[model samples]
Target: MPAERLDKILAHHGFGTRKDVKRLCHKGLVFLNGKIATDPAVKVDIGSDTLVIDGKKITLQHDLYIMLNKCRDVVCANRDGEHQTVFDLLDESLKHKFLGGDLHCMGRLDIDTEGLLILTTDGKLTHSLLSPKTHVPKTYGVGLRDALSEEEKLRYAETFSKGFWIDREQNEDGFNCAPAVLKWREKDGKFTLEGENPALYEAVEKNSSGKSDCLLTIFEGKFHQVKRMFAQMGNQVVYLKRVKMGELSLDPQLEPGSYRELSEAEIALLKQRQTD
Candidate 1:
């Protein structure tokens, strides 16, 4: 990418328009590479140069690939009339300033669901990731209302590995979903082993009133698939959060409702296909 003006970078980060940037510059409020800034028109290296305003880091990237930590109550659509959308987590700066147009959400998550969501301007990448033929894996952290017995967990894992029948009432595709993977999790969605893991059903049985948690990975995109899959097993998902998509994992440092630009290495991981 080519070099960009300092004020433009600030404006692209939602610091304000060029005029506002000039004001900040004149007040000695802008700092470039730890030095006080006096000029707003100075050119900057988008990747190497760091810009700080009021002690906040300003990121300026020409190729935008955002990893948003979505929170509950937000829809995944580009626009929504009933509730907030994922893009709403971004500032007005990214829309028209940095990015030329609206950012597209690669995969859609339910309104009540939260966690990792990829937003990019690359159409081809989006097509490749979302296409059903690609069979890209998406992993979710799940919380169930009832504690699943050891047998039930085994059955669930087996059912996921082999294509299973969706309750006909929920889906009429006439074909079963592709094989998926399921694993146990602690209450906070951290991974644990099957036998050595105390968070498994065996531990839940001791309390008798605790909810069970697990991690689920699927290759297909179906409406209410994860929630409904468990429902068929006489279990209910009280909470759902997507933790991984394709080869990208949500950054733990990013808090809910916050987002960060994907590093170049992370971007490459998304395009790397798995081989058997």
Candidate 2:
């Protein structure tokens, strides 16, 4: 589908607000396929064409997929306490643009545990990943108190799929827990698994004897979901890292407290979820 509006395209690129984009369009600052465009309503296919804004080529990354090696004591949100937020690490220009009412985070990761995070201005993409019905999988590297056993894996899965009631008063409504699809893999004193491997399923089930880290996937995004899930397993999550969300992965080039524009392929994956 061709992008029907210039402001939409600009917003998709993590440029700025719709009004701000419209202003740029009216000022002839936006270019379509290299030619100056003055109409905010101009239609263009983001996938096939190259867009340039103010001499900088803009690839309409429909949604942003960010991977942050979150440092301790930082929050994974746009705004928070004295501790810096994940958004604080982004480029000033990107911060100014996405910080506006136009953009938001797809899900929340605790301040302590950090890894892969997906942020975007596209609400539909956010919905697809956050919705319980869609079951978009998210993998995380977890730190545990002791080794995991075969029965623990079964218990973890059972508790995640059914639901657990949390006692904490973090949520105003009530402490209701949501179900998730949980699995863990152990590696070298820490449970680890590559995104690409054949025995990943079995690795999560194998019993290991040691205080180690584990990798797990959760299908739901509730308040403190990952940490709480581990709490139920009698394991404290000392560290956490999200590896994937749907078809998007944290860009290898982006480091801790850093972000970049999403590539064309990643945007296409997000757009594809609009229909399915």
TM-score of each: 0.68, 0.65
- Please state the error at residue 117 of candidate 1 in Å: 0.1
Residues forming the 10-long window of minimal summed lDDT in candidate 1: 200-209
lDDT of each: 0.76, 0.62
Candidate 1, residue 127: how far the Cα is off, in Å: 0.3
lDDT of 1 by residue, 1-276 (tens): 568788877777777889999999999889999999889999888778888888888765755789888888999887888898887788776775453334688878888887788888766678777777788988777788887677877888998899788766534553487889888754564566543334223322322223337778899888788988888778888987787787677776677789988988988988785332
Candidate 2: minimum summed lDDT over ten consecutive residues — where? 203-212
Q: Candidate 2, overall lDDT?
A: 0.62
What is the clash tally of candidate 2?
A: 5
Best by TM-score: 1
